[model samples]
Target chain A: MVTIPFIWIMGDLLWNGWDQLSFSFVFSAPQNAGREGGIGPILISTLLIVGVCMGTAVPMGLGTALFLSEYTRHDHVLGRLIRGSLDVLAGVPSIVFGLFGNALFCQILGLGFSILSGGLTLACMVLPILIRTVEESFHAISQEQRLSAAALGLSKTTTIRRILLPAALPGLLVGIILGLGRAVAETAALIFTSGYVARMPESLMDSGRSLAVHIYDLAMNVAGGNPHAYATALVLVGLVFIINVSSSWIASRWTSCNRLSA
Target chain B: MPFSTFFFFTLRVFLVGPLLWAWAWEYPSARAEGERLIITGSSTMAPLVSEIGKRFETLHPKVRVDVQTGGSSRGIADTVNGLADIGMASRALKSQEQHLNGSVIAHDGITIILHTSNPVQELTDDQIRSIYTGSSTNWSHVGGPDSGITVVNKAEGRSTLELFLDYFHLSNRDIHAHVVIGDNEQGIKTVAGNPNAIGYVSIGTAQYDAAHGIGIRLLALQHIPATLETVREGRFPLSRPLTLVTKSPPAGLVKTFIDFAQSPQVHDLILQQYFVPLQG
Candidate 1:
């Protein structure tokens, strides 16, 4: 049963593959019905959203992980509450996060439907996952590393920024990769919150849509389903592949550096 | 017979699988063959199209109709681009959209909905324009409660808002500051929840009571109620035609869909869905 669905999905892609794999369709925007349009700007917008999401998520998620693993080792009430809150926040669906983003960032915060709002919402979704991954990395590091850093008389913050972060870089990169994938693939939350203008995102606050949203919009929103839905899907898959491979390569490099230093 | 059966089985494994795969990937075109009619656009038109699709599919079991909803601009865009066999729009076409044919499937009243507790009864045309355009920012200015008017608006390019702007001549107005929701369902919920909030939504989605909140009150404007009669008679200013646009005038299955959509059964379905039929 599982194999059949996958086979069908692949077959669908293969059947449409040749017509969809054209460079012009990849690069052009839609002019009208029964014609062609490039999705170049949309592709860039998806990348930008993923980039901004990572930019915010990495620091925040890393900070949370550091606080939990190193700073708040002693059992405390506030720490426990914060941990509980993080769990709840992570558990919340992407749609709810989108609603919150719409209200808090887009409306109350007055950042209109822009890349910034979508990225920030996605950051909120990814934070818990990033934090958990980073925390696990930090926990895996021996206590001897922390003691040695203390022996060097480095400040707690400095140790976290330099010693612990570099040590946890491999796992941290994994968290980032996962978050990037989520941000790139996510649609429902983005539809209402991000605003789906096709133009390239000039600033953080400009309204934009990702590849997934673009595909959905084309298939479900537009007539004739845009004929390029498969192409867009292919592009999204390709983009995800690029991000994962690059992140994996960087993680491998970082791991090698850590080994050499050790 | 055994040799032939084995040969056929081999063909199924290779040719059938590859063909099916190719069919799946082929720009949503089913060789432009068979009895598949793909319809997309206008969530407002979705319910109506689905009803027609269900009946149509039953009549011709070999035929399949896929209905998808984006919104009206998308519907028009899809029709112009040949993505949909029919693009259902709640608003009229733009001047640029003259390239396609827009047939009115139904008519809808755009209700000025408020929280049930809101004592404000009516708004003038000028007041409506000012409120939506953000000139009059509070209910106190409009002879309502002392609360600041929370103007919830549909996102830009939404067909409903497009019609409202054109009807009221508020096209150049800056509505970017309003709390912009995407669909009619969300707009109805937002207004129903907040007593100080005012928003416009289709009459179909406005009828249901909000989740654990007060039902919304459809405001009367300038002695013209936002009702079925007022909308059909063209007394209500916010009323607009709902359409299913097609590329180059639909033929075959597309023509059939348009025909069924324009029929009395569809009109009855529209009535049940709380939308006034085009003929009505």
Candidate 2:
């Protein structure tokens, strides 16, 4: 039943967009409100937005997960408080985050409607999910490993660097991939933050349209924009598929290498 | 150990490389800042303004025009707050917003639509209100077949919905919609597919789609035909101007861009988007 919807959507996209997909379609700037030309600028903007999101989210998520798993007991008041807030944040609608981001990042911080603000907003939205996933991965590590590291006279930081991190690498990769998927597919949060400009971004401060936003505008707002909208959607789906497949491949290769070393 | 080290090294490079590249690109542009005009507001007017901005950019090589869309209210707010060089509002500014200067570029009309298969040729204002409010659920109640009427309404936050409500003297809460749609095309599609469905959408979009044999019909209002000619003549009761607003009198690049937008050179572009250019 689940696969039926997926197949149906893929078939529809291919049926409508296959002829329109070309090298120029992916590499040229959009003209006439996306009725013609390609999505080159939009592609770069999506990449930069996702890159900024991952760059900020990974470090913060990793640190928070480590602190939650290693620096405090499971029942510690502060840890519990942080966990509670993260859980709540994970459930909050993305539109709320978009509004908050617009107020804080775009207005207060003077980032204006730029890729930086959009990326920062996406980072905030994905952090809770990333941290929870990574923390669970950390907790899944056996206690015997920690005891063995302690018996080896290793410091807490050393134990984390060598033992916990390597052991939990798959989970960390999963967390990052999940966060990337969310950041790339986001539309509501980005529309108000990164904004609606379809120009090629020369810098982080320039407003550039993301692929999802382009698809949205072409599909809903622009009259007779369906052909290009379908093509853009097909490209987005292809991107998500590639990200998922490559992440799983990397996870498997890393695990096999670790087993060989052990 | 070497494998893990290599992996972390690659990861670090992946994360930090983009940041470094972004900063490097920013440096040269920062030193040589060019003229940038930011236009924000009204999703309805955004596509047209974007096309105009593109032509404007080609004419002025060094200048950049950035267009953003949220809604008409956002356009007003952004303009008043000085965040935008110009704001695009599809409707005229209210009395309180009169402080801002508004220049009309085009006109768009909202029209009632039905499936062409529907036998009802016309409806009075009272009939439409009754049908929308659920007081009249059958087409027979409004001089049509005895089948049930499906009311297709625009979703909340859509300017179309707001305009619809304003023209009909009805609030959103009073609407008993059978199907809520997001855009003009969607509403037209829904009504086209359903023999008994009635909806309202942009007259230009409806006319284009109907001409292309989309199985939808545009209904006249108050005995006047629902045609582009009527709208152009300013006889359409439910029409709104596509306006460009500024906090202060436009000067410099902003003034030049607005003038170019209103000039006859872009009338074909305006007509191409299915909006009526202001007649000289």
Candidate 3:
């Protein structure tokens, strides 16, 4: 029953977006708000934002997950507090994150409307999920694995670096991929933070538009850009699909390779 | 299908759900409304129409009044197609739209708005033009702080943008805006957030928000204030007629609605919506 609606939507995207997704449409900056030209800047901004968000999120998420899982007792007050906070943060709506990002980065930090502000906002949004999932992955790694490394006379840090991390690698990748998905799909938080200007960002401080915002602009506010909006959606869906398939494939292969070597 | 494929399919479906509904749902007509007067058009004039509609409905209890907003273009199109009894337009009718009769109901204008914390109280006409055209880039360059000036512009399909472009003698492509926002509130919010930002929006909207402590100030153009009194007194230079457009000269319920909209009874209502009434 659900598949029927799902197939119908895919057909619609193909119908609306097929002819409009030309080479120049994917490669050139928009002219007339996607009425005449293309979505080049939007694509670049999306990549830059996702890159920055992931770059910040991965290190912070991994470090926090490692500390909470390894250093603290299960019920440590601070750990509980951190976990509780992460849960609450994950529940916070994206629009609230947009407002917070506007206040902190755009106004207080004086970053203004730029890709940097939006990237930071998405990083904060993805952090909660990344930390939770990564922590669970660490927990799922058998305690016997850690003990085995300890019995081999390896120091705690060395054991963690060489053995524990390697065994938990697939799980950590899964967490990161999930965060990547959220970052790529995020729209509301970026709306206020990233100024919706359809031009190539000259610097990190320059405001840029993402595909999601561009699509919203073209589709909603007026009539002339409807065709372009549908085409942009098709491109966005295709990009997300490639990211998901490749990342999960890499994780699965790495996990199997580790098992065989062990 | 695999779980991943199904999950991905579901996500795409969810995203397109609204589009599907829009495509499937039939456009509502006056016939569908039943004993109601359907008004459609610019979002700017929507609130005023509803206010007047409520008053008219009370005066004639049997007739229900419904107002919907898409934009001015939708207004003209709906009226031409007989989908609406009256179309609310925030700008004067273009020459191509001569077939429809547009009655001037009130007046409003696009005016420059700045954050209350901004030091520059006003700007010269040339400076305002330069700022929008990318000639003036920094606030300090324009008698303000050292921060770069953020220019917030209206989106396409808005009458405010149309009036702004016409008044300044600038093309849409000439606007070097840092942000493009839809509707008056978004423009006000953008200006309120940035200390060095300037935007053009309806003067009435700016005045109303300023009174409500929204932390934005409307800058005088050519040294004439953009207050309600000034707008009424014909001192505001960037003003546009707020018109009630009908496909042809209105009659029956449509004519009554138009007459009521332009009458003295809605003067307070117009003033409350931040518009200058066309008459005493």
Candidate 4:
């Protein structure tokens, strides 16, 4: 049943977008509101947005995970409070995050509609998921390992830096990858923050449209933009597929290397 | 040990990469060298204006025109707050928005649509009102197939819904909608897929889709055939002006861009987009 939807979507995208996919289509500037030309600027904007999202999210999510798993007891009041909020945040619909981002970042912070604001908004949205994933990975590490480190008289920070982090690397990568998928595929949150400018952004302060937003605008708003919309969707699906495969490959390779070294 | 090193290396790259890219790619005071005009609002008018903006950019290398779309109200709000230099609104400025200056660049008509296979060729305003109000539930009552009618409606806050409500003299509360759609294409697709479905959308979009062999037909409203020609000739009853709004009378680069948009140079672009240029 899960594969059915995947096959159906892939089939539809391929059937409609195969002919429209070409070198120039991926590397040229869009014309006539994305009816013609390539998605070069949109691709760059998507990358930049993801970069900002990951850069901000990784440190914060890792710190929160460490705090939850190492610095505090599971039943500690502060830890419980943090977990409750994160659970609630994870349940909050993305549109509410979009509206909140618009009010706080675009209006209050005076960032207006820019990639930086969009990235920050995305970082906020993905933090709960990232933190939860990393925390679970930390917990999956056996208590015997921690007791052994303590017996060896290693400091807490050193144990975390040299032992815990390397062991939890795969889960961290998975968390990053999952958060990345959500950030890249996002349309609603970005439409309010990053904006819909199709220009090649020269700076983070400049407004640039993401691929999802471009696909949305082309399909829903612009007349006669169906073919290009299909092509863009195909490219987006391809991108997610690549990210998933590459991350899994990295995880497997890292685990094998760890086994060989041990 | 190698794994730890590699992990730290990846961490450093993630932490420092964006900052280094931002520093290296930062333009040396590019804003001072070039003028940028930010225009926001009205998803319907965004594409046409974006095309005009691109042409304007080619003409003047030092100028940048950035167009953004949310909705007509956002356009007005942005213009009022000075967040955008210009706002694109697809409807006439209401009395509350009289302080803002508006310039009409083109015209778009709203027309009733149905599946092409349906035998109903036309409908009176009273009949449409009855169908929407649920007083007439079956297509047989409207001189069509003997099946239940599917009433498709635009979501709230869409200018199409507002215009529809105004023309029909009905409130959104009064209509019984089976399906609510966001954009013209979705509405068209719904009606096209259902032989008993009836909906309304931009005449330009409906005509384009119909010409492309989408199984949808534009129905004549009040005996006037819904065609681009009628919209161009100013005889279409339910047409609205695609206007650009500014907080005050436009001047300088803003005025120049607005003038360029209204000039005959962009008529081809306008016609290409299936919208009726203000000029004949």
Candidate 5:
């Protein structure tokens, strides 16, 4: 029942964008506000930002999750404080994150309107979910698994490194996938940080517009930009779908490989 | 049990019925005591109309003036459709739109703006054209620092965009824009933020922002300064008249209000909003 509207929207975008989504539309530089030619540069910017966001978020999330689960007691003040802060962070609005990102990364830090600043903002946004997911997965591992690793004369650090990490791989991948989704779909946070420049990112300092921002700019500002906006949305959906499938495949292969080794 | 439930539902409805009725039935035109006037169109003209409407209400005491904003097209449409008593337009009426009468109420001009820190104080018309066309890539080639120039352009359908394109003799499709902004403030902000960026916006707005210490400077247009004095003297080239449109010859309160808006009564108000008066 919930997915009825989702299906309807997807169908509508595909129907609208299908005619415009040709090879030239995807490969050539936009001639005028995505009204002509292609979204080649915009597509590149979108992928560059996703790469940057995932690169920053995943390791930080995994590390924080490990710290919360293994290093501290649940009732410890520091642990409780970390958990409380993560909860609050998750609830913080994306627009507020945009402002904060502008003030800190763009202004104070002097990163300016670049992919680096946008990626950092997205990293902060996805942190809470990452921390909670990885922590839950690590905690769900049996007590006997740890006891056996110890009985086999493995050090606590070694057991956590080899056994715990591989065992929690599936959950970590889930966290990565969710973070990627949020990062790919994000527009507000990137508006202030990355800016709305439809150009290839020459360096980390160069401003670039992501796919989500491109749709927003095309759909809202330009008078006759709906077709291009729909096409970009369709392409964005396809890209996210591909990422989702590939990550799940990688997770499955890991699990299967681990099972064979054991 | 069903009867009790039904009784409770009817009781709840009875309790809320009057509140909903009162909300739906508004006391129309109570303040002005008589006729209602609807003014629609041109977002740029909305503020001025709203200001004049307030003053007109006080003077008439028996007429209600309502101001609405969409765009110039809506203003013309509303006038033609009899949806509004008057339409406000920031651009000149087309030949097809000449079915309606338009009276100039105020004047504003578009001018090039830049970050205050840029070393280049003025740019030649050709230099600006080249910059907009992507022929001039670096700020240093035109006398600023060596950096890639970011062109901030206005979105389509805005009268400002129309005026800019017409004045430059360029098509909107040809100019490569780094950022396409909707409003004047956004253009000013984009220019203020980027030392290498240049954009055009309402000169009055740019002047106001500059007075308030917003790090933006208006450049001279074709060797003539963009100032209130120049615009009033008819020396500025980019000037556009802001008009109040009427489908038919305005009658009653609409006639009275349009006359008042074009008279000396709202001169101070118009100037306060950083627009040139109809006479000036």
Candidate 6:
């Protein structure tokens, strides 16, 4: 409780100043020292990286889940192996993922410090959680739905698409939200792979920094640290809260609609 | 078409297209051979090191210099951990950093900057200390216009902030819980743009600004200007050395790079990069 208010006070110290938290600081290009400017490009770059990671992870996660639960029998060797592998993948630390991404995506693929490299690296990090949640949602469906779909002579793919996927949409959305939260908050992996430039991402090839990295840079590298650190922290917390609440609300609404249709 | 086909198509459009696009464009080959120098540390020194790296690589086409910025502490840590060939810092090393061989590459003076619109010309060391430590919250208490003294400081783990505190003899003084910003540039921006603001940054960086959009007025300490001459003469209170540390002294390609860095060829380059070159 004490730390929470202290955190808020820290945030206000950063944003309260005209010079530190000006509109230009957020919107325009940064100038040299003893000059006024903005960080609009970095903000946009952060969002672009986050968007790519979430977009890729959601579908891949759902597909893995579907393969594990609906399509494969419990006794199948491949399904068991994949399930076990996912459990291990989720347990691996983020720094390890960063190392892997640096080697595999950045070095082998020629994607030097690009947003695409960072996002793709993040997708690999988020994939395990996505797969697990989506699989659980598929498992939670009632046996009766499967029986009824089979009775109707619905094709395997059709039953999965129209019935299982729609039924599991809410849980799948939650998985996506969770993945997004992790991706947005992540700093270590993106720091090495994404690379920090002050400009907005021009292409998948452009180097960029996420908001968390920007906050870290501001608090640690930019001089006179505390006020800017706190202010950037405030912005970071606000962003995370917005993403969390909005995703939860959207997921709940979709789930309610699915229930009504069922 | 079946809903499955539609869903697959949706997945393909959203996930596969972008993922493949990112993968193909970003990842380059990971082959490591010949001349490769990995450097990590202070962001303040990153641009400087990068410039030197660029020059060195031009001379030796086979060499590749990869520079990454973490904080100064991380730079020292990277050098200790054998993760980097060089660790760059804007401040002196701690006792822990003593295990590595440290060489002074350059020197910089930390200038106390304020907006030019403010009427105050110079601030006494005590007044500066009182304001930063929060003993004086308002600018008027220190003979300036009546406004809250918005003290901007570096975060924990920064060598620049640590050096400043030491310079002010405020190492033990509890910093007013509010003042924080990270780099010298941002501090200059915050102070130069705000009438009531006071902050610190490297004089070298201040000189790099040609437009002077922020109009930073440097404060003199105890009748001495925070100039490179005063800093070299040991008269300036806020001057500090820039050190490059390594776990082991340079050998092979790394030695060639270090020798090049210390050469007169890179001396002019250092001045162009806004840092004063070290004299033998």
lDDT of 2: 0.90
Residue B143's lDDT within candidate 5 is 88
Model 5 alpha-carbon miss at residue A168, Å: 0.8
The segments of candidate 6 whose C-alpha lies over 4 angstroms from its true place after superposition are: A1-56, A63-121, A124-147, A153-158, A161-163, A166-189, A192-262, B1-35, B207-211, B228-235, B267-273
Q: What is the TM-score of chain A alone in each candidate?
A: 0.90, 0.98, 0.95, 0.98, 0.97, 0.87
Candidate 4: residue pairs that collide: none
Interface Cα RMSD for all candidates? 19.2, 1.8, 15.8, 2.2, 22.9, 6.3
Tens digit of per-residue lDDT, candidate 6, span A168-190? 87677678778888888888888
Alpha-carbon deviation at B91 in model 2, angstroms? 1.1
Candidate 5 Cα deviation (angstroms), residue A256: 1.2
Model 2 misplaced regions, further than 4 Å: none
DockQ of each: 0.02, 0.64, 0.02, 0.58, 0.01, 0.14
Model 4 local distance difference test score: 0.89
Give one digit per residue, the lDDT tens place, for model 3 in A1-262. 9799978978999999999989988998665335667888788778777776776787798899999999999999999999999999999999899889978997789786677898889999999999998899899989998898788898988977777676566677678778878888777888777755554555455566788877765664422456788899899989988888876776666666565665
Q: Against the true structure, what is each candidate's TM-score?
A: 0.51, 0.96, 0.52, 0.97, 0.52, 0.64
> How much lDDT does candidate 5 score?
0.78
User: Which prediction has more favorable lDDT, 3 or 5?
Assistant: 3
Indicate the residue-level lDDT of A243 in model 6.
76
Best by TM-score: 4
Model 5: lDDT of residue A102: 74
- Tens digits of per-residue lDDT for model 1, B1-280: 2322333354244224433443344444433444656566777676567667766766876676656555777677667666557788887766888888878878887778888888888888889888878889889898987888898887776777777677678763566345787767677667767889988887655643332244788877678776777777777777778877887877877887788888886676677556787665
RMSD (Cα, Å) of candidate 5? 22.1
Give the Å shift of residue A132 in candidate 5. 0.9
Q: Residue B198 lDDT in model 6?
A: 81
Q: Mind giving the per-residue lDDT tens digits that candidate 6 earns over B159-205? A: 77888888888863578845577677667767766778888788776
RMSD of each: 17.6, 1.8, 20.6, 1.6, 22.1, 9.0
* TM-score (0 to 1) of chain B for each candidate: 0.82, 0.89, 0.86, 0.94, 0.88, 0.85
